[model samples]
Target chain A: MDVYLPIAEVSVNAPLLLALGALVGFISGLFGIGGGFLMAPVLVFLGIPPAVAVASQANHVVASSTSSVLTYSKAGSVDYRMGGIMALGGAVGALFGVELFRLLRLLGQADLVVAVSYLLLLGSIGALTLKESLTTILARRRGEPARREPTRRPLWLYGLPFRVRFPRSGLYISAIPPLLLGVFAGILSAIMGVGGGFILVPAMVYILRMRAAVVVGTSLFQILITTAVTTVLQAGRNQTVDIVLSTLLMVGGVLGAQYGAKASARFRADEMRAALGLLILLVGLQMGLSLFLRPDDPFALAPGGAG
Target chain B: MMVPPGPPPMDPPALVAPAPEPPGPVVVTQTPTISAALTNSEIEVDSSYAGASLVLYGAVFNPGDDPVDVVLVVRGPERPVRLVRKVRVAGLWLNSRPVVFEGAPAFYVMASTRPLSEIAGFGVLRRMGVGLDHIQIDAPDEARTVNLYGVRDVVISRLGEDYLEWRRAVIRLKERDGLYRADPSGVRFVDPGLFRAEIVLPPEAPTGEYRTEVWLFQNGQAISVRRNTIQVRRVGVERWLHNFAFFQPWLYGLVSVLLAGFTGWAASRWFRRT
Candidate 1:
């Protein structure tokens, strides 16, 4: 069925949108990460305006992360002290990022900036994840135990001021690192319309040396807050958030995530990670190649700019 | 009143008659008059709206048997359009040199009984803005008025052919989007002087007042013209949401956030129960 989205001012197939949301949601749940990076780009490709796609998908992130965070909080896996500090930094960063996005839009460089950022970030991350996962898988196949990550914290983390103890994660570290990491995640979320969990989990594990048990939970908590803020800001300032579109995506995402989470228990971790890495790499490559390829039409038209 | 004649002949009179009659004294008759009306004056765009097609039925009142062609031009609301040209910059395509058209119609579709070229002379069609090529799209920065031999003439500076490229790009892009179109045989004559044309508004049609001009052409001249309007606006939930987003953006944002949070919480509870 076709439905006209009010804010985007376009008619789109409702079932198609729901299916897209469900597919992305399933991937996110299987990988234990928010799927904003995948959803936003797909929405753009499906004919939603770039800005609207970015903003509206942020709302979907909020719902998915909220549910995940609730489960984590119930299990007492979340580090509130750490997550709160990061969320604070994220809020400020998200506000700044939204304003910057608005300025880029006025300059007519928003789409270029978005595409370039996605190409670079996704390409690098995907390559690293694939290489690491493949190395582990090959080592296991050769009858060797999986290599462990180093537990030692970086020296600079100790050197920073404002040190605080996180009881849940059982860590004593300077608060600045988590705060800065949160700010980075917040900026990324606002610009790329993602929850930034993929980046945050690794950063927390390697940089802050937080416990693995609490890392995912804390990251989800931070993402929930930051994306909520981003959604509100994008809607208020840019008027690009389409609630109807978001709702359709959320309904499918919520159901799909549950099933995906159930299916994750049957799969090996390294293989799943490798598959996700390959998928991300392919998407990144496609977006990157589009910039170099000759366009069908060199001219584009948009309304609402000053004449 | 003269029995509203029958459906038009299949072939043009010129094709069937090879000989021309000797010139005779002109017999002046009643001036031709045209009237048109849309089947629906107001098109409500609800959530189910994909696109809309309206029937524009009209009639030309001419006493004599002089053949006349029907032409209809449907123009949607005017909007300021920014045209961007992508330039290859250091191996990556980037948008550069944006040209702004102050007032360009969001939707423009011209339908006629016969091809515009065959119905009228080039000058007549151009002057009447009968086809896509004749439509005026002006860029303020590239246009100026200068006095040539004591007579003021409005001249459009071409900016060395680059500006013209942007102007044509606007039409080309709009055409690709199905917003601007020209159909040579879109108008059908139900009876000799009665005609009907279908105006199809695509899903991307801008919502506002659409002006449709019906022109009656005879002997390469527009003898009669009639104008009508169509109002396209969002209705029901669509209108409410659009107005809320634009008028009370902050509140709407808050509502969106709250709704998202609630949905998340509800999903968690539902899954937990399951």
Candidate 2:
């Protein structure tokens, strides 16, 4: 049976959908990572049409980010000006990403492209996060003080035209870093139907060297704007937005985010990173296994066929 | 703000007489020939007398200045049934018209123009299933009369799984006007023992050799009933391939992997410099 969501107009199961949202919400809240990676695959496994799954997951990211960002903001951990500049860049990147997607579809190379990309991306990000968090945990057990050193800021950020001071992040960096991050995140958001938070969070923490407290907030703010724009664009151009599905997912997701945020407060930073790493690894492995598995049936009956 | 006023004048109408012109040569153009083509011109129906509804479809085209009226006639064992007659405007038109008629055993369709215009068309005649007729039952010698539609306290047994089992209540009649109208809603229980099933004879019902078994019950008791046979002629292709491309799950997975990969690659390169 098909069930409709209150807002997204997409049809999916009520119970299963809510469960997925809750699970993802818990993870997102626990870890600074946006749960788009886990949500999109799970949705597809649940028999949602792929396009709908991607688009709806992107929508869910916006909602999830909104809740988390609120918490981070209250903690005085967001760099609004930096985040805004990045978001602007991301919006532009998203436009180009969509065009590239169309061109690939026209060439019938969409499948190969998507498969290879997922295998590499999820594999690398998952590995990196897992390795970093494990090292941090091992160091604490050995009673070694965690190393903290300040490096000179990148010259590119300083030389860029828009130089802005982010008091909270305590950094006076050019807008180039945020803008580039935004553009890349926007492209990824359009193509994968993710909020690009998974990508943004890491970039903010490591590349921009923003404090961990501010990184999550800045990433969420950018994700909310970019993904929301993507949702509208996908709806207007392709008429693929299923409000019913998105609403159902969000209903469960919003509540989940609250619980997730609360639960996240109790966990140490390394624990959150480790969990995210494992989740990403699992998704990556699943994608790889599918390539070798023989499909159930190569052909099936279609509409307008002879009775 | 200030307001301004303007004035205008109107002229009166005039009447004048005009002279008639001399007759000129008359040019007559032949009426454009309207025609239609049948993609599949012929159709066949089998066992029309059985309890089944049959339908015939065809495409009609008009190529003339005026519209063409087309009529369909079916001749069966009992009488002729006029299926339909409709006007076709001058242009290309495809018709999948539906024809419904009552009680007929084997019928053929004929088409013609009301004003005798040239037209062509082709399509198939499909034999849909039979129509159900009214069912009636009489009370047993020991039980009180029970009416199902309006009578309360009537105990009706559960129907069997097979659709044909209910055929016991079907009442077949001789084909008349090459049509039979079945009333599926008229089935009801009058009492416990004696039961009747009604069925409308379709023009394409089988010629002979058929068997059907119907059950009878009262107050949770099974009554006596047996099977019978009637012949039927089947038509049309049995199987065909159905094409469904968009629902393929693998396609989705493949696309997802590629997109994720591209973003990941770009992200790694992007983060390295910083």
Candidate 3:
């Protein structure tokens, strides 16, 4: 039952690992989020070193997104041109994010940064999603149409230079906005050790106002590349990725995703959003509580510690 | 410490009686000789490698009809250790300060027939550097160790006033991870003047050279000491990957990405075909 993870240099229960992967993958399929945010924290809670957990989870993200991207491509939902431009910006942002990650680690404040960021991102995102879902549900009961505001581009974003046309999204917006959005997501992807799909999907849908059909697939395509970049960088620079751990997780993730995708149609969209919001809220609360609780033993040894 | 009624030690002519400590006098007469050997001198870690139990056996050469005690210390490689002290800041436990410890061992385990205090005096243990309390932490020469009581900024609690507390915290962390252990009654005698102890290494133990030392004591004073070294390393695929990760990290990273991508692609195709 015990298997040695080479990079982690630790023995872990194989079955337990498979189960954890399945759970994360199921959520990934159900919600269409990259699941990196969920996987990293859970792995840390399960006693994997933070660095290893981040690196290995990045690898798993690449795998899951790869499969999903292929399906999206077949469905003619992917916007390759937009995905490529964002990827270019994302690459630059990821490089900067890696350096920032290294700096925080050197300051011996990496854990603090991770915990605080998780709390802020999860708390705000969860609250917003819950609020939106509730409003939509209540509006439907009263036989009212969903509120639609006149699409007004922010003046600052509109005036930015280097305007480009995205035919699929039917927008001739300035390239700066999409590129900047990609950069923000990429930076978050590296710092959070996730694929950034949760942030990306929203940014594409609302900020750029892309078609809903294009949003999920284009975002998945971008995640596949960004996380692929993350995996290589973490492994090459930090040497924290555990191949065995990632592989085991990927196995269960694929199967769980299959079942999750099949069951997605069974639930209403609002109900699914509410469930995801609740899940995120609970995870955020736990992380918030940890920040206020004193650890029993604070001394730690790291082989590649703040060197 | 008991001697069964059996034939006396073969070398009776050299049987020297225990004597009082003297100032630079002939302490050789009361010196108790000891020897030790580990069951395994090399540990190979493979895919199925979980953990290993190592046995170290030794005997007090000059029994001399006197009851003697043995203490065994097995220590792993030395590494720099860091400890963080969390302080409640605005109702949140923030990592307010950090303590850096130099020359902390990666793994440490000690066992003796009886409690170390009963076997040897504090000075003796201190001289031998066997007990946990007696560990020598190399403090920086410039900084005279400081304590934490809300200094102007985040305080770095180095080795000085709060040294003991920091050291205890280190031990607690190691024990929680199953890396450090102190078993007072772990060692036992297989026969009169002969003793053996088990040094258990968890599967997560760092691969490095480990030192096992045995200290011989008579009349509650150390007489002699012997040491042995064991090597732990990875073998097979684990070894290959470990070497690749450290030596050619960029290539390893590329390979990891490619392999994961391939698996994902293949699995997707397979599931679709089904």
Interface Cα RMSD of candidate 1 = 4.3
TM-score for all models, in order of appearance = 0.90, 0.52, 0.90
Name model 3 segments beyond 4 Å from true.
Answer: A149-156, A298-303, B1-31, B144-157
- Evaluate residue A92 in candidate 2 and report its C-alpha lDDT on the 0 to 100 scale: 89
What is the per-residue lDDT of model 1 for residues B206-229, given as tens digits with 9 covering 90 to 100?
899999888877777776677778
- Candidate 2: residue B211 lDDT (0-100): 28
Give lDDT tens digits, candidate 3, residues A1-307. Answer: 9888888878888999899888887787777777888888888887788888888888888787777777677878788878877877777777787777766654457778778878887787777778877887888889998678458756765688888888887777788777776787677677787777777776776677787777877887777788788878887777888999999888877666656655776988877887887777777777777788776655544324323
lDDT of 3: 0.75
B1-274: candidate 2 lDDT, tens digit per residue = 0222111111111001111111253222221111112222222222111234322222222122233232333233322111211212342111112121223233322322221112221111111111222222111223232333232433223233522232221122222323233332222222321223333333333223322322111111111122233333333211000001123323332332233333323422332344
Candidate 3 C-alpha error for residue A180, in Å: 1.9
TM-score for candidate 1, residues paired by index: 0.90
Model 2 per-residue lDDT at B200: 32
Candidate 3 has a DockQ of 0.44
> Judged by lDDT against the true structure, how good is candidate 2?
0.49
The CA lDDT at A113 in model 3 is 78
Better of 1 and 3 by lDDT: 1
Compare the candidates by DockQ and give the number of the best one: 3
| Local lDDT at B64 for model 1 | 51
Across residues A69-124, which tens digit of lDDT does each residue of candidate 1 receive? Answer: 77778878789899999999889889988988876665556768777877887887
